[model samples]
Target: MMEKIWQRKTDETIGKPILEVFPELLDQKYPELLNDVLSKGITIRENESIAYIQQKEKLEKFYLDYQYTPLFEKNGTVNGIMITVYDVTNKVEARKKVEVAEQRTRLAIEIAEIATWDLDFLTDNIIYSENLPQIFGQEKGSVITRQKIKRQIHKDDLPVLKKAFGLALQTGIYKYECRIIKPDAEVCWIRVHGKLFFDENKNITKMLGTVLDITDEKNSHQTLMKSEEKFRLLADSMPQHIWTSDPLGNLNYFNKSVYKYTGLFIDDLKEQGWIQIVHPDDQKENINSWMEAVKTGNDFLFEHRFRRYDGEYRWQLSLAIAQKDEYGNIQMWVGTSTDIQDQKNFTDKLEREVSERTAQLELKNRDLINMNIELQSFAYISSHDLQEPLRKIQTFASRLSDLDEQNISAKAKTYLGRIEVSAKRMQTLIQDLLTYSRTNSAERVFVKANLDEIAEEVHSDFYERIEEKKLLSIFTL
Candidate 1:
């Protein structure tokens, strides 16, 4: 079968040496493999070799994988080599492309400063990327062992790393953030993400992960926490009520003043507890306004009455402003409630005093008005009654004067003239008094009056009486 398969032309061609039949095996590339199989009497051998060989019509280059085994004679001594060939050109090309990809990936990892690691569970060997030294701040070519990496980890973080790794053994996932002391003795934080590989029996076979530097992120968080603590301390030190709420207007923090004024513990004032401290009359309006402000992220200011610890409702001015992020999203509402009870009390007192004084002035005005009306009525009645009596006296005196003076004694006639003159003077005095009363009693057009003109009128009436007196004087002498 072997002779037929090789198509040997004669028995001598079948028993000849391998190189005598296939001379292409004489290349230097396959020298070691040829020695191991043909000269060393090896039991079995394998190798990959390339060669140029004559084909049906042309010479071609071929990549071949060969398996060589020694054939034994009847006496058990090695006789010749038996060979098997397989073409592996495509496999070789694929392997070269894989190597190129790996090179590119390694370059990318270095540029990104990522520290990649693979740990073989069975051998307890950890293979780290070339960039591991840079991440750990270690010198170039420094030895990196599992124990050395463990030593670099902070004492407080070692147990955390171990626990996360242990959990990965069971869960096939791992994540951890820990601090490590760098080669320069400076501490830095790192975050690690890992995936665990399992074998058929559910045993851990390997772990693959990457580490990232996170020192900047860690420091920023610490600073923010410290700033918040300081703000809380300052707010608690104030006497006025201070509070904070989320964007939804749900209260989250209240200062010490809030508890002191309301006489309520923090636990007691969790949800809507602030409403209880507000006076019942003001709660609805206050809550509505606050909700509107929160929905719109606008500032709010209002005054309402709040119940104090002593069960007294006092006026307070409540103001709140929304805290916002750079994107204009509301983060929280910071607010203060200041006492305005004293100012409100003062304003009430002032208003009461003004109202009382206004009432007193109105009462005095009405009394003065009533007195003027009564005085006007009395003046009218007195002027009417006195005019009738004066007319009767003048008429009777005239009639007496008309009685013939021839029939009267001279002394009697003189007395009658004097009586008439006195009656007329009394009438003039009454008219003057009436004019003065009318001036105060009613509205009148006031013209410029000369006192001398008024005196001259009265003097003329008395002058006529004086002439009559002169006549009487003549009779009496």
Candidate 2:
């Protein structure tokens, strides 16, 4: 380190020969070290004075690497070094921070289309985001309160929503939907999805979220529902008849057209009362058969008579169907009937007219009728015609046996018994054929016959045969 030497404008440099004995004089100038002038120059920084200012940080001394003459007092000149030494580290660091903050603001605006805000809840004062005022519809830059926001919500949806800030204060998070009143008085739905700001103890300070207008989506849903309702209403008012029934073939729906054809309305009919118009004789059988099919989920292909509006009964062919669900429940049924009276009349008339077309046709067909008659006729003919020959043969064989009793062997008797057995077997086959051909021919008319009783009669016949054969036919069912 070296001491600084100050020089006045008019002072001269110290001589080296006197400065050698007292080396401190090397820092002096003029007479008596010219201390007064130099002291004044050092304190006041005069343009006519010179100062050796060491370039060092804090208390350290330094050498000047570069210097130039500096202008001092007015009308005066000073020859000295103007040192240029500066520590610029703090300045550069401060400039860097300013640049980074500017970049962050630019990026945030570009990415999110958002700005910042501050609010004072108790004072009801609001400091908006930079973009907020430009984007607001009717309430730009207005001081907002909890009440003001609540009033903007749609009247219909108002009952469900709470003040966002109040809810945020009580709860840790805030989420909801609301509508806003636009500048043009148009109602707009905005979805606000966000988080609530909190302090260390989880006390909410403010709420923040993103807002989106969703008016288009809500409008679409309402339009679709209205279209669906129109379709359903049109179907209900249609004139074409649509009906469904239970498995028992009950009348579940009688459309307006059906009511117009039949004089009776749906409520006027008792369960299956439509059967009453069936040509009385066909009613029982037609109803019973159709119902039997319904119980088993089978097709109901039946023809019946329906009473028309003109007080006449017309034959109708009804086609019915059933629908079953995954659990096999009869989910639904469908039925429709078509007029078939003309076809039925034509068929009946033709059958009567062609009953006796040929005598040969009658003979072959009549032989297929009446099993009991066929059996009696066979017995009557065989007893008179075949019995004589059979008896004569048996008598002759017996007479021959007696004559050969002393001359014939036992083999001869066995051969005679075999001949009798063969004759009996042929008689049984002829009786069986006649019975099978005539079964059910006598009762050919189709009716609602008592099937259970008919089955019982067949059972009785089997029992009688079993008793005669001494066989017990045990039944488990």
Candidate 3:
């Protein structure tokens, strides 16, 4: 073994001096150690001692376990040194690599603010990482034990941790999130994860675990909870029945108005659905519309009847819109149901009244048409039948006027002349009446009129009456 380590033949080293066989030892502690063993007649041993040896004409490093003992002469004087050596390079190098890896792991844990611990049941002691003390707000290098860790836990959380430990004994797994109080009395959240080890007798022998500070995460969660609570309170105060659903169309939240209107609790709605409150006839359409809106992520609008708590079904106009995220993905559905029973009743009443009024107007319009036709016939008859007799009177008076003056008396002539003038005026009045009636039946065309002619005609028609009343002077102009 020595020859192989020295890269030389056994015969070359067996009787040779130690320095001659291994010239590199002259610069190392091996020579001095050998000298001391010989002079003092003592022995020296070393394990895993580093040495540089010449191999293949090049210096190489090695780890060795070696011993040096003095060989004594019968007179009790040290004569020589006996040496023993064994190579331990592989074992030592493996240990060094393991130590380096362990150091790196410790550094990573510290940077991530994690504490690792190991508990030995037999020793009733805990071995923890360097950062464990700091996690509990203690000075560096402070000794940590299971009892010390337990004391740091919040009083309310101690029982929880105990329960977790008890379960771990049976399950071989430990997991819990709990609150802890630091030495400064600051409360914080932590998550612990561990695994249990058991001996052959099924007794827990050791436990290894890691702890993480989760205070920031817990604080953020709490803030979100408070905000949601505020939203719920505001929703409850509204008069409209409001509700919300998950992205999958699962109804999850309902406002106070919904419960008051439907007279159903949340648990009751959960077992079935809000559709229970829909009027029986509207249920099918309501379900279809809602499902379509959810599938397409579109707004929903439907007018349906909702059964009230008092057993009366009232009309409701329901509208729902999808709440979307930045990516345009549906996050939730917000919906409202507004009571429109009164408005619906008003609309129906107004339609009925309008229909009745329309029927009455049609009847009145027919009567007006019949009355206009009768008036037109009366005007035609008055123009033809009445004017014919007046024409005969004027012709007869003309014939009489043509007779010799001696044949008719002056009184008879005057009367004949008055009769003829009256007949002519009556005929003119009848003709004017016919013209006015004809114009009324169509679009009337207005024209400039001679006021003098109209006045003369009026004077002729009333002249006799005016003369008899002795008021003829009124028409002198």
Best by TM-score: 3
In TM-score terms, candidate 3 sits at 0.63
Between candidates 2 and 3, the one scoring higher on lDDT is 3
Which stretches of candidate 1 lie above 4 Å from their native place?
Answer: 1-115, 123-134, 138-145, 162-173, 195-204, 271-273, 307-312, 367-477
Clash counts for the predictions, in order: 0, 1, 0
Candidate closest to the true structure, highest lDDT: 3
lDDT of 3 by residue, 1-477 (tens): 755677777798877787877788889987787778877888999899999998986898899999888888999999987788899998999999999999998888878889999989889899888887877788999988888888888888888988998898779999999998998899989999999999899988998999898899999999989988998999999999888899988889999999999888889999988888888999998889999999999999999998888889999999989999999999999899899999999999999999999999999999988887888789998789998899899999999998999999998998899899888878888998887876654667779999988888778777778879988455575
The Cα local distance difference test for each model comes to: 0.81, 0.58, 0.88
Clashing pairs in 2: 47-72
Ranking by TM-score: 3, 1, 2
Per-residue lDDT, model 3, residue 367, is 92
Residue 386, candidate 2: Cα error in Å is 44
**Per-model TM-score on C-alpha atoms:** 0.52, 0.28, 0.63
